[model samples]
Target: MANIFTSSIGKKLIMSISGLFLILFLLVHLLANSAYLFGPEAFDLIIVIMGSPVVVAMVPVLAAGFAVHIAYALILNRMNMKARGAQRYEITHKGEADSWASKNMLILGLIVLGFLVFHLSHFWAKMQLPEFTGGHAENVNDLMHLTFGNPYIFVCYIVWFVALWFHLTHGFWSALQTIGMNNTKWISRLKGLSYIYATIVCGGFIVIAVTAFLRANGYIG
Candidate 1:
């Protein structure tokens, strides 16, 4: 166990597991947020269900998973930087076949993380935080409209989604590959699956954002 924490492969394995966990969580989150498409009543019902004891119990677990993933990612990135030393840029260019996201995972991750803080301020702080603290939660649809309705915020979210899409494109298959799915037979298949999964998840969020913006501005409902 101690060796696992200290070894390179061990750290990667941990990162892979945590990344997969977050990927699963993202799908669940997307499904929950999709309820907004049905109507405010449906969205609120999903929110109420999310506030139930079972989901509430998992909040700390989710937080810990995010912490572990972010911490390990930073550690591995720093190690790679040191290993590359002055050759970092040159080495990055050498991987011509590598996806852009593969070469710049750290940058994409930082962008996603930065926007995530802004997102939490707009939504989670108003809804989850208040509910957790026994205060009245805001109307989910109203807040969604108000936040996504802003042209600036809407544009920022689109940027965030784009970054997230790139990040996921590489991270998804890489995580699986690290977890012993590196056989030639599986390699291409995994990459294909990664693209599909990333497209669906990010695409869903983009659609939701556009819908909220339109509804908020009286363009549609």
Candidate 2:
């Protein structure tokens, strides 16, 4: 077991599995957030369902999966950097050995992480944490509007989502590649699917942010 974890292939396998776990979580989370499109009542119903005892009990599990994913990524990245011995991040040419997204996963991941902090501050801090601490929970639909109402915050979210798009475009395919799904035919298919999936997944969040921003500014009915 120890040797398996310490081996490069094993570490990568861990990365692939944990990454896929997070991907599944993101899809489910995006679906839940989509309730806002139906209005405050529908969105609040989602919040109620998700906040139920059974779902709340799974929060720790989800957090642990995310933590494991992050830990493995950092460890693998550090090891790769050490092996490259300071040539780790130099992409000086358009035809560099790897795709731009492949070379900059760490930077993209960090940006996403930072934006998550910003996002959680606006929503989780205002809603979940308060409710957990015996304070009133804010309506999630209203929270979306409040968070995106500011043009600056709205722009920030769009930037963050773009970064997330790049991250997932690489990550989705890489995760599959790492797990032995890398035949030539499947390779092309995975790349195409990655873009489609990433766009759909990230697009969902972008639409919400854009809609909220426009609606708050009275740009639509």
Query: Which ten residues in a row are the worst by lDDT in model 2?
Result: 88-97
lDDT of 1 by residue, 117-183 (tens): 8988888888889877899888888999899989999999999999999989888888887888877
Give all candidates' CA lDDT scores: 0.87, 0.81
100-146: candidate 2 lDDT, tens digit per residue: 78888889999998888888788878777775799987877777777
RMSD per model, one decimal:
2.7, 3.2
lDDT, residue 95, model 2: 26
Query: Which residue pairs show collisions in model 1?
Result: none
lDDT of 1 at 98: 64
Off by over 4 Å in 1: 84-97
Number of the top lDDT candidate: 1
